[model samples]
Every structure is written in C-alpha cells, then in structure tokens.
Target chain A: MSEPRNVKNLKDRINRIEDILASVAAGDMDARIETEIEDDLSGIEAAIDLLIDDLTDELRQREKMQKELETKLKEIQEQQRTIVQQQEDLLELSSPVSKVWDNILILPVIGTLDSQRTQIMMENLLQKIVDTGCTISILDITGVPTVDTQVANHLLKTVTSARLLGAECIISGISPAIAQTIVHLGIDLSTIRTKATLQDAMIYAMKQNKRSDEMKVLSRNALSDEKED
Target chain B: MLELAPDRNFELLGEYAIETEYDIVMARQTVRQFAKKAGMGIVDQTRITTAVSELFRNMYNYAGGGKVLIERGDVESHDALIITCIDHGPGIENLELAMSDGYTSGMGMGYGLPGTKRLVDRFEIQSKINEGTTVRIMKWK
Candidate 1:
C-alpha cells in the first residue's frame, strides 16, 4: 500500500510539471512551476524559473537600449538643424545691402566669397534695386581675401541679373592677386565696369546720380515752359 | 598611383551634397570643424574650407549636383584629413589644360582646380569625358 502511495505522489508531480510547461510555451512569461514538494522534480522546476528570469532581464535591457538610441538620434537631428539655421543667419549678416545714396546701393562684401554668400548678395542687391529703384549698385570687395573661378562667375551672374532689372552693377576693390587670378582664368569682365577702390566706385555712382537728377529737372522745366506758352 | 593604406583605419566624418550654394556653406563649416579636430591651425582650417567650397561649387555648377566625402585616417604615419569630391558632369577633355592656371570652360575665372591643388598637401584627380570627375585632396597634421 505504501509503495502505491509513493507512485501516486510522483505521478501528481509529473502532471503539475507538464501543465506549467504548457502555460510557459503559450507565451506566458510569468508562469512558473509552483511546488512545495521537495522531490526529484524540484531541481527542474527551479532551473526553468531561473531561465525565464534571465530572459525577462535581457528583454528589459534591450528595450532600455532602444529607447536610449532613439533619444540620441533625435538629439543629433536637432543639432544638425540648428547648425543649418546658424549658417543661414551668418550668410545674411555677412552680405548686407544698404542704400548709401538716393540712386546708389552699396553692398560691402567682407571676408571670403563663397557661392552661397554670393547668391545672397545678389538677391539682396536685386531686392534693394526694386525697392528703392536704384539705378547703380556698387559691390565693394575690399575685405575679400581672394576670388576663385566660381566666385568670379557668381559675380558675373549677379552683375547680369542686376542689369536685367535695369541697374548698372559696378564691382570695386580688385586686389592685385584677385586681378591676376581673373586674368589668368581668362575671364572677360570688359563689359562690366570695375573700380580700383570703393571711393572711386562711389564717386562714379554719385556722378551718374547727379546727371540723372539734372535730366529730370531739365525735363520738368521744359514741360512747365510749354504749359506757359 | 596614390592608394589608401590597407592597414590604416578610415573613419567617415561626414558627407554633404553639392546641390545649392547653402550646401556649399554647410560643407565649409563641417570641414572647418573636422580640420579643427585634426589639430590644424586657423589658417590651415580656412584653407581647407576654402578648397572644399571651391570644389563643391564646381560640382554644383558643372555637374548640377554631386557629393563630398570627409574622412579621417592615418596615412603614411601622419594623421590626415581626406576630402573626396565626386561629380557626374562633363569630364575634363584635357587633363593637363584643366589643371593649368588660366584655362576655363567659359563659366568662371578658371582658377578653381589649380588653386585647390595649391591649398592641400596631396591632390589627385580621375576623370573620363562625358562620364564624371573625382578629386581627392588630403591635408596632414
């Protein structure tokens, strides 16, 4: 009778183990083999629980790392966007178009000349020409260290674009090195008026402005005289 | 004939598009930062950035678009910064003439390629007419 009882106890423990395993296999990570019986099956039950615990820890760690990576990516993107914005701001500040005379616009280009800055300079000059109806624009490059082929081409484009708006563009402050580079590059700026200094460019613009003003005055006087007649 | 060393480590610092003028500016800024990391002086940084600007502008104007790669490596026992510019534009018909100081394709002053070569310590160019052009320049610290 005692042997039969022991066999029945072993069978019950085996059944419990099978049920716990089935639950675990169905994706229930929390399922465990709960048994107070200190028997041969206890070791197997303890090992299964330890495996689940390890798996859970690893999953949690992986999730944490994923979140950290996402945050880092966002930060990098934000930094990139800020840098782009700052560059745009710098370009805007570097190229400033101001109306120095009633009919003259002056754009002082300091530092280095790049394609992007040249584009901004062109845009600013064109917009100012439209706004103030200025007929003459002087691009002062006294502070520019050098000019390359591409920059020279951009300058040509800017001058041509200004002409399209019915304004004459004059580039001033041709450093000797820049002049040599231009000549060596075989760029023909013969059609575009250039000055040796900003002062000279300013004087030329002022003279043109005065002449236009005189023409307007003469025309107004003529109209008044005809009215009187 | 110049080759990157097999044993040397090559790390990509950044890649930029030579699409718009703004892209050129961004490339210059990035190159400046990279040059600084290589422990270059302010003047060297400016030179490298200027070279990059010219190359990027060339790519934009000639090819309509291209790419610039900035990398850091150990070359010939010295720490080096490498800039590679690739463009799929009309390749140079005469490599010698293109490298000359006064030759231009009628768009610019024609000092771009030669001036860039003067700025860097190492310069190499590979091109095929109607296919594209690649320029590799390196500065050492």
Candidate 2:
C-alpha cells in the first residue's frame, strides 16, 4: 500500500512539471515549477527556471545596448550636419554685400580669400547690382591679409561679371604686399580701377553716382530744350 | 627623405582629404583649429586657413584628389604647425614655371602654389613628372 502511495505522489509531481513546461513553451516567462516535493526532479526544475531568468536578462541587456548605439549614431549625424551648416554660415558672414549709398554697393571682405568665397562674393555683388540697379560696386579688402593669383583672378571675374550686369566694380584696400604679389604674378589689373583704401573707393563710387545723376538731369533738360525748339 | 624628423615631439592634430569643394571647407576649419591651438592670433589663423583652402582646392582641381595631414611639433628651436599635402596626380613638369605666378594648366589665376608659399614661414615641394607631388608647409610660433 505504501509503495502505491509513493508512486501516486511521484506521478503528481511529474504532471505539475509538465504543466509548467507547457505554459513556458506557450510564451509565459513567469511560469515556474512550484511543486514542494524535495526530489531529484526538483533540482532539474530549479535549473530550468534559472536558465530562463538568465536568457531574459541577456535579452534586456542587448536591447538596452542597441538603443544606446542608435542614440550615439544619431548624435554623430546631427553634429556632422551642424558642422556643415556652420561652414556655410561662415562663408556668408565673411562676405557681406550692402548698399551703402543710393547707387553704390559695398562688399567689405575680411579674412582670407578662397575660390568658394570669391564665387559667393561675385554672386552677391551681381545680385545686389540687379536688385538695387546700382551702377557702382566697391569691394573693400582692407582686412584681407593677402591675395593669391587665384583669388586675384576671381576678383577680376567678379568685376567682369558685375560689368556684364551694367555695373562697374572697384576693388579697394590694396596692401603693399598684395600689390607686389599681383605684379609678381603678372596679373594685369591695368584694365580694372583699384583704390588704395576703402575710403578712396567710397569717394570714387559716390563721385560717379553724382556724375551719373547730373548727366541724367542734363540729358532730360536737353530733351526739353529740343522740344521747345 | 620627406619624412618628419623622428626626434621631434610631434602630434597629429587632424587629417583630411581634398576631394570636393566641401572637403576644402573642412580642411580650412581643421587648419583653423590647429592654428588656434598653436596660439596663433586670428589674423594668422585666417592666413593659415586660407593657405590650406587654396592648397586643398588645387589638390582637388589639379590632382583630382589628395590628402592633407596637420601636425604640431617642436622643430629646431621653434614650435611649429606643419601641413603636408600629398597628391597622386600628374606631377608638375616644370617646377620653375609652376612656381611662377600666373602659370596654370587650367583656366586658373595660377596663384595657388606661389601664394601658398608666401603664406607660411617655411614651404617645400617635391614632384616627379609621372609619380606625384608633395607640398609641406610650416608656420612657427
């Protein structure tokens, strides 16, 4: 009779373990072998629960690391984008074209001159010429330390481009070193009008503006006199 | 023969490649940082950065592409910042003509090389017709 009773207890414990495993297989990570029977099978059940806990912890850790990696990547990309934007802004700030007078535009270029900046300077000067219908543009380079052959050429191109838009471009603030470099490079600035200082350039531009205004008035008066005649 | 002195305590500040216009801009910014770190004033920083910009542009335009290495170290008795530009492009055939102003194979103002030379305290260039060109410049503080 005792043998039968012990066998019945063993059978009950086995059924409980099977039920717990079935629940675990069905995706219930919370399922555990809760039978209090202190037998050899209990040790196997404890081991299975420990393995599930370890797997769950590992998966959580992997997920957290993946999130951290994604965040770091996003930060790096954002920083790169910001750097690009700042570069563009710096270029724009370095070359500023403004209308200082009624028919005069002034672009005070400071710092070093690069091809890209020169291109931007050219575009800005040309656009200002069109927008303001200004007849004269002055490029002031008082703060510019040096001009290489390429930058000088870009200046020439900018002047020519402005001329095509029916505006005259005058470059001012020619440092002695720059003048020497220009001559050494064999750049012919003879065709272009240059000034020694920004003030000189401004004076010249203003004088031209006044002269044009006076000419317009004179021509209008002459037409009136012709009509009367 | 073009290697930096092994005895000098030199550190690589930054490095960049000249492949496009954007890369030129990046090179300028990098040079600016290095110039600042070397305690160069704003004007000197601008000059160095401008030189770098022109060199990088030349590398991209003439060489098709090249690399620039920025280094800082004590050379001789002076603390200097060194910039090295290397290009695997058609080397200059006539070194003298190339060094002259207004000499360009392209429709450029031909101020790239000579202008770069003037901007730095020390400048050296080596080239072979079919091999490549290397330009090294140093600005001392």
Candidate 3:
C-alpha cells in the first residue's frame, strides 16, 4: 500500500491535470500539463496540443477564405453600382429633346447595346416623344456592333409606341452586318421607314420642316393681304 | 425474373439519371452539355452553366422538384439557346422580394434568380398564386 503522503500527492496531481484539461476544453491552447513525471498524463497533453494546432490552422484558413470572399463581394457590388449610375446618367441626358425642326427629334445611340440598355433606350425614347409632342423621331445606330431579337423587339416597340403618339420614327445608319442580321432573322420591318444614313434622314427632316414653314407663311400672308384689300 | 423484349433499339449504358436533392449537379451538367452542343464559346458556356446551376440548386431546395427544357432559337444571324425551368412546389409569392439579394427563405444566399437573369440575354418569368412558376432564360451565340 502507498503511504498517506504519496496518495495525497497523486490526488493533487490528478486534480491539477483535470484543471488543465478543463481549461483546454474551454479553448485555452496555452494551458498544458508541465509536470516532470514520466506517465500517461504527458501523452494526453501532447495529443491535446496536436489537436489544438490542427484546429488553429483550420480556423486561420477559414478566416482567410472569408476575407477573400468579402473582398470579391465588395468589388462586385461596386461594379454593379457604377453600371447603374452610368445608365441613369445616360437616361437623363437622352430622355429630353426640343423638337425645333418640324417636330422632329433625333436619338443617337452609341456604345455596345446590351439587352438591358436597349430596353431602357426604348422606354426613354417613347417617353420623350410623348412629353415633347413631336411628330417625327429619328434613331441612329452607327456604334452598335450587333442586334438580337430581344433588342430588335424593343426597337419595334419604341416605333409602335411613337406611332400611337401620332409620331413617325425613322431608323437610320444601320450597319451592313446589322442589316444582314435583320434579314436573316426574318423580322418584318417593311412598315418602318429606314434611311441608309443620318445625313439623309436629317435632310429629309429639314425638307419637311421647310414645307410646313412655307404653308404657315402662305396662310399668314393671305390673311394680311385680304385685310388690306 | 422478367423476359427481355426482342425489339432492342436500346443499348445498355451506365446511365444514372435521377431527380432528387443530389440531382442538381447532374442537371447543371446536362445544361452545360446542351449549351456546348448549341455551339456556345467557352466563356459563355461557363457563365450560362453557373447561372443554370444556381437555379437548379434553388429548384432542388425550394421547389423540391422541377423540369428543365433546352432548345435553340435563331434570332437574326445569332443562334440563341433557351433553357426553361418550371416548378410547381412552393411558388414564389413575391417575385420582387424573392429577387432581392440577402433575402433568404432558408439556407441559400438568395442570389439565384437575379444572378440567372443577369447572365442571360432574355429572361421571362410567369407565375401565379397556388399554381406554378416558369422561368425562361435565353443565351445568344
């Protein structure tokens, strides 16, 4: 049998080990059993230290990935905001027009036209015509590289809406490739009045303006001359 | 044991096509194959496959079951491929609310529908209360 003093010492040792384990379980990796004894308790301490090391490495990797994901998400949100702001500015600039020449309004579309931009363009153009009381509108598409059915449909809707508002829309400056695409798509643009160049459409609009001006002048002069007689 | 039919237009292959929670991955692969067959470029194929995968996972988690259909449409000179996903289970009540990012009904991050819409050239959605939902997406080549 062991002496009473040795039993007390062993009990104390076990209590110390238990306290260290409790601390470790509470995520205290620094709390380790440091007794100068060659026994099973040392092995337990070594195994626990290894487990904590693995856990720390895993937690560090997780944090790094989380930071990277957050950075990427921020970049994407910034990009989306920039795109939205650009579209808004463009819409503001392109939405208003004064029909100074024979009630004709010109809308020049530039840049790569995506489906969303095309839809916004159609809405802006139609709304402008309704507000300005214009009888004629010209759409120029020289900078567009391609056209699809959805975009073409948006354009068609714009023209139809303009006609309903008692205005005529003339599409001009369609590139050769775009014309081929329109043909291959078999879209019925027979009812639309399309001009090959913006210069041609402008000249046509100016001629219509002159005719209306001449008619007005004739009516006023006839009334004055009749009053003089 | 069942007897085999003499008319054998079907050859046996290692085919494991099923519709379940785990089938989302297969559905995404099917969409990618369809896009490739429709002659999409590598970048576009990747974008479309990612978007479709998002929607397929949503279908598995939210609707529990859905249908996928792929077809080709010639828009002008462009050959556009269309994929449609339809589901009858737990139709979205408020589409606008559902489309908002960070708004989730369960565990998802809620980026599926909006992200899918952004990736495609044309997106169409038709859903009714107590009925079902149909989402049509088109990618132009």
Best candidate per TM-score, number? 2
Model 1 alpha-carbon miss at residue B114, Å: 6.6
lDDT: the better of candidates 1 and 2: 1
Please write out the lDDT profile of model 1 over residues A121-225, one tens digit for every residue: 888889999999989999998887546556677788999999999999999998765665455445678989999999999999999989999999999999999
The per-prediction CA RMSD against the true structure, in angstroms, equals: 7.2, 5.4, 13.1
What does candidate 1 score on TM? 0.61
List, residue by residue over B1-141, the lDDT tens digit for candidate 3.
Answer: 111122223222122222573465576666667777778876567557666665666666677777776666665556777676777766788989876654667754455566567667877777766666777677898
True contacts kept of 2: 0.19
By TM-score rank, best first, the candidates go: 2, 1, 3
The CA lDDT at B85 in model 1 is: 88
Clashing residue pairs in candidate 3, if any? none
All models, DockQ values? 0.23, 0.29, 0.04
lDDT of 2 by residue, A163-182 (tens): 89999989999876567655
The native-contact fractions of the candidates, in order shown, are 0.23, 0.19, 0.00
Against the true structure, candidate 3 reaches a TM-score of 0.50
Q: Record all residue pairs in model 1 with backbone atoms less than 3 Å apart, i.e. clashing.
A: none
Compute the DockQ of candidate 2.
0.29
